[model samples]
Target chain A: MENENLIEVNHLTKVFASRGVMSKGQIKAVDDVSFSMPQEKPTILTLAGESGSGKTTIARLILGFIKPTSGKILYQGRDIWKMTKDEWVRYRKEVQAVFQDPYGAFNPLHKVDRVLTIPIRKFKLANSEEEATDLISEALGVVGLKTDEVLGKYPHQLSGGQRQRIMLARAFLLKPKLIVADEPVSMIDASLRASILNVMLDLKSKFSISFLYITHDLSTARYVSDNIIVMYLGSIMEMGPVDKVLVKPLHPYVKLLIDSVPVPDPERRWKNRIELPRIEITSQSLQTRGCKFYPRCSQRMEKCSKERPDLANVEEDRWVACHLYQ
Target chain B: MPDTLLDVRNLIAYYMTPTAPVRAVDNVSFNVTEKEILGIAGESGCGKSTLAYSILRLLKPPGYIRGGEVLFKGSDLLKIEEEELRRIRWKHISYIPQSSMNALNPVMRIEEQIGDAIINHEKISKGELRKRIEDLLVSVGLSPSVAHMYPHELSGGMRQRVVIAMAMALDPELIIADEPTTALDVVVQRGILQLLRDIRSKLKASVIMITHDMAAQAQIVDRLAIMYAGKIVEIGDANDLFNDPLHPYSRALISAIPSISEKKKLKGVPGFPPDLRSPPPGCRFYPRCPHRIPGKCNVDEPRLIEVKNDRLVACHLYR
Candidate 1:
């Protein structure tokens, strides 16, 4: 059955083996995570959380770099893990990635052109050197880089912003249906980040490409995303429209994350101080049958520590996982 | 007339390699007042970190302080002898590096590390040293029991607090923090910044914070100095700098920050900063300045001058 969704992740869970400590059980990196992207309209959905929040684990799972312990990832209404060889090849071409460290993404020893050319040749996007050159130039031009300036330079020779743009350009060449950008602009400077972010927006609007923008920075996430999924300790805390999720966050964890951001305006400094956990818990320390955020939640109910809260649709378009909301 | 803790005049530092010399910190001048938190804001490669290293006189080989005066407590740090500089370093002027985990000794306990920094300058008994270490740890919002913990055993935030405790051991008059909260998460960053502010008020110490995060800078800094291509392009009070920026680069920088309050168009400066080895002939920011006056900005550089009350700008548009 061909569902009308672009991507559906149902009960996707990934558990890694514990390291070093014998007492520590398996690390539940991602636990029962589920979401779906629509097929009709392209959307920029952000997965936001702090360091140990399993957001990156979801990205890795979607990219097929690691398989889930149990559950299913349906790509275009088909099981991605069970795809045939030819279907997998098509899936690979349709889904692309842009990573956090642009400097480390490419080999310093090779020329910058190799980043775009190899993908083009492998995908057979163009024939002949001249044809490939024209296509590469067009992709670079879309990202506001001239072929003459970037073609022959090494990765070390280009600035961090330029190198990241080159990565975006390479992804653009694939015309991928989805791009999983993990902390894409975190390493770049704030001044140059706007350009790179705008490039992603341009790609989405101009070419109908969906973006899975993963970031720890809430300000940028609010700026670019149409929808947001707040994750913590390998589970969804809240999911809704960007304004509803960020501006007026339902979950306490989401509120804390938004409040923690040091807004640029000095006039509105944080009025209240928040007490933080003395020690951050690792994934191996997740609770068996309670809210993962129960330990650190400011408004923790007695029931929160006893029974795990299911993600319930509290409002028209907003969903939250908290006993208070329930 | 105000109490100036440190005064830097025409400070120029360069990184010399086989190919060419990178003019990292060129003709930078600023004053840090007593008990004030002055922020040095700029993008990467703008020489803010180099300025921090130059102030400490810790520039390694091939990266030399070319010329300038770093006057701390009415003494020219550049002209001071090695013995005198050593006495002043860590005792009078401490530094918190970007990565606190890397700054600390992984194998050493937090209390012992703090003891090593303090006992070198003061003659204290072992018991008194432990007391002092506990007191310092408590002052930075960390529990006194954390004194015996190793760097690896603590979380990233706790390790940073440990670094802060070490920097504050001698109760230094001035602290230079280069991207102190760069790698930490936002929650941890806010806690760290709050700790720094609390320390400054309690100890009445001056701070020269260097970071590219404008939003984070707005939280604690009293004054801000925006650097571009190794030069201090604008300096003003933090509120004034954000509300009424005089330099085009500073305006673009402040505007580039994404705010969650509203969805405003963020305009990134069109081009990258100039290469320090061979910068532009006139204004270093001319290539990327949207309000550049042709022929004038490209041909003649603007000098930093006092314009409105207490604000300084280096721009042809201002003149």
Candidate 2:
């Protein structure tokens, strides 16, 4: 039997039309982005990029919160866009999201228990109130949250780390096959970030649930993700295994990003000044017939300004979008 | 400490509510020498920002400096009058506050806001002011054209750069940047950090970089101070501290940071940072510390004393 794809996003493009009269052009947020998650085993694929690099747009697209301008999202080898009402419900149940801000994600007026109980009730994971309580407690245990500490308390009563764990516990209640996390640990305290990541890794192993982890922090991404996609201005600069790409990058943009990250180790401080564009990267679409990173690429060629290089496979399991690599 | 530009001694700033006083910055002491960058590292609620606010004398109602002194260039800043402080502010000492989005006024243009800060301190002709504002913008890697744009018209990173430019507008002897690049991306963050380094070297000004990100501190900061529950747990040279953290909390904080180049089992400090309202006695980090001694760490609070050459730690293990 052929291997099935759990989630496949093919040539996705999302463009936001300029709403204000001052802005004349549309913003191409996600331009021709494509990737897939395998069905056989649990995998964590990270979409790493800077702000306005379309990481969040891809996450919103995968969650079905917004419609893509063009392309198809395949869930379990079936077209998600063409799914029926019943099928859509199943798809929604299977794929869930965990947002970055834990404080804003929850309702202040409601008790923390409400967040967990409603998902269990909506999915019909438990039959009665008693079963729901047991399910909630079990899910809470998985994310390292004690039942009593979080069950009846308000969001203000608990810390940010606790609130984030509660969100994870709620996701666990749904038993999602794919969890789309968009910078989940960015807002959380650094000391608490690792534990939450450990919880995600624990869930990945125990339940075999895949994760589409999206973040700008490369360290955490490399720590948790198996495969990585380096994005820049709504396009993939490089895509490969996490270890290979991060440890030794091929593309100039990826190399710049890696070098830019200030590692905790002071022994290897950044020595050379990174060449950057004189102007900040605007939200406007790059409509040039050339490489998008040509303005800032330190090793830009004459061909780079004239032609856009497609993401081509350069080595085994590694793809880079640069004329030099080709 | 004779060459120190900003010297904070046992500073105790607190938030007084109807019920009780929250000691946001309790007995915190450090110094920024001339032409030095002192990086204050800590988690949220650790009172890093409170310390900065207290030194700058910008504490609002319900939040006031309770005790301790801030000595800058042989004079006590905390004891100065409001009028004296107003003259000193942005001229001798300036601030780049956290969240540049809210720092810049929505109604004012970039140049006008910078001009307001400049005109308050010194007397200059209108053309000279415009030229100075443009020069400041250009020095911070921003184009002169950006001066005409409003705060909302610029991006988050651009707003942060503008904030940096405004802080350096008066050639202040000292600059306090509180989480300068917290919300910016890594690529943009690097550029901002570089700009700060350039500003420090070119102007020969002291900087107090207060942030929770140790990774960002390692890049440019000369000295590092780790805080927990409003207390400086450890203080030393940046390279020395990152290589060998004496306090258990500091050690846990350094290790908890996930590395991109290296993968290891990150042992996060378990438990939340102590609440300032009703803090536990003894050491603030005792509850979460891995090397906690039951009687010693839970009963008596450790003082930040010199353990090695130019290194100080507030843990019983060193004592």
Tell me the lDDT of model 2 at B309. 95
DockQ of 1: 0.71
Docking band of candidate 1 = medium
Q: What residue runs in model 2 are displaced by over 4 Å at the alpha carbon?
A: A281-285
**Candidate that scores best on TM-score:** 1
Q: Residue by residue across A1-326, what tens digits does model 2's lDDT show? A: 25769999999999998888776777889999888999999999999998878999999998888999999889988888899999999999889899998989778999888898778878899888898889988999999988887888999999989999998888888888999999899988889999999998998999998999999999999899999999988999999999999999999989988988988888888788854344555655453678999878889999999999999999989999999988
Chain A TM per candidate, in order of listing: 0.96, 0.97
Taking all chains together, each candidate's TM-score versus the true structure is 0.98, 0.97
Measured by DockQ, the strongest candidate is 2
The interface RMSD for candidate 2 is: 1.3
Pick out the ten consecutive residues of candidate 2 chain A with the lowest summed lDDT.
A276-285
